[model samples]
Target: MNNSAQKPGLRERKRRETLQRITDTGLKLFLSQGYEETTLDAIAEASGISRRTFFYYFKSKEEILLAWQSGTGAAIAAAIQEQTADKAPIDAVLDAILSLASQFDANELVAIERLLRSTEELRASKHAKYVQQEGAVFEALCAKWPQARRRDSLRLIAMASMGALRLAVDRWVEEGTKRPLAKHLRETFESLKAELGRQS
Candidate 1:
């Protein structure tokens, strides 16, 4: 089948567009005004949707904030898949994560992280997001190296990779470093490798 035949229909496209608009509007308001200060009614108005319509796309403002994080897992998964098969699994995952981190604008990331940290609920919920990312990375690794015996090792790599990423982000944010996030990610991955006695 052709790509067009596989693509979403017009109605689906419209729904996606509307959903993105709402997410973008909410993120803008949250970043500029403050997450606690932004209201559901304000997001609905800014997105050109009724409050009821907003509910059709998301149940709450927290969900909208989650939406701002939507594509990252898939991007990481894709990056892992794109790595040359000759590379070791750990190296591939490290490259994938670094690529993703490099794409993020440091200032915007700081703003978004601040907004997320502003709410106790968001901070708690964010762990679930990391878990989801680990799953994505694990699946991608398995697809690339499908030996059944490797499954356990792949799972560990996924978990450890995500743990390192979280540590890097936390330190980067706390220090307010002007350095690029990719640098932090690389350093974290190096520490991870060293802790494992340089075993890939």
Candidate 2:
């Protein structure tokens, strides 16, 4: 078997490299200069691509920010799929989210998040990102536990889980703590569970 046949061809590899370069250059400019202030020409120039070439990779500058959010959402979904079947669905989702949080460089996330909230347009995009992420989590859970009866419960858990994560990240960013994001996630989950328990 020619396993080498499965490898990406030169064109595909080059495409991926160019895409990465654009994303990296765009993000750097977005973070260093404010998102609205950074122009497309600046990103294209920094990436060594033509302005028209930038449109081939992304429809708009906002798409670049969403691209970063999309990657995080996919990572959460991937982590959810990796959870063992025996664990409670909520716990599995929590662990997956915690794992994702643990991987982030706290300072980098703080900067990115601040940028996301810097303008009205970006704030709307940030909210949309959360909605998309919640959908991703729900879809991943439904895949993991295929029982029809569990659909509604899984949806609820996904919503609650994302809520916990949002609260955790907000507090973590507000405090600008050296403490790890995972710790904030754990505490947020604990508080959520405790509050729910009180209601029950």
Candidate 3:
């Protein structure tokens, strides 16, 4: 009912459409010409946008591949941070991962995985993003587990849990995500905790 409200909504829609066009066009060119061979100029031209506009959307060619992979871990990190004091660490970790994985579209995740594997740079970028995300999760977990008898035990748990997440992602992609990623992650983390708990 408000003209000004509708104007912002229209602009947001236009921005999404433009970004999608750039993403789609850039991805297509990367595949066709090869990831290392693709150029921003070609991508911008194909997307019917100026080079400057493409730069505004993506800082570099590798950024397009990194974009989808970067922000994904934030949800899991935040979920872990918000766990109640009474929640078991294992349950909190699994539930955080499960919450994030459930929000991803499996099919699209598969495509992002494919693109991520295309170059060492892209894979490294993905790893770097997850590393920062893991650091954040670990800090949040340390604060939550204040009564931990040994600080090293909490650190080990954080390291091992994040490692399990990486393995789950690998399995999820290799299996083409036929099953829910949340299930894969939960089972993997549960198994890791059980195995490690026995050793501790």
Q: At residue 156, give the lDDT of candidate 1.
A: 93
lDDT of 2 by residue, 1-200 (tens): 89779999999999989987888889889888878899999999999999999999999998888888988888999999999999987788889988877777777789889988887988998898999999999999999999999999899889998999999889888888667788888899888888877988
Return the candidate ranking by TM-score, descending.
1, 2, 3
Q: Residues 1-200, candidate 3, lDDT per residue (tens digit)?
A: 87886565777888878887887777677666877788888989999999999888889988876654545556666788777868767678778878777776677667767778877777788888777767766776787887667467666667777889889989988987787888788789889978977987
TM-score top scorer:
1
- For model 3, how big is the CA root-mean-square deviation? 5.6
Q: lDDT of each structure?
A: 0.88, 0.89, 0.77
TM-score for each candidate, following the candidate numbering? 0.93, 0.88, 0.71
- Give a tens-digit lDDT track for model 1, residues 35-121: 889999999999999999999999999998777765677788999999999998889998988887778778888889888788789
Cα error, residue 199 of model 2, in Å, equals: 4.2
Which residue pairs overlap in candidate 2's backbone? none
- Higher-lDDT candidate of 1 and 3: 1
Q: Runs in model 2 with CA error above 4 Å?
A: 1-17
Cα distance off (Å), candidate 3, residue 81: 2.7
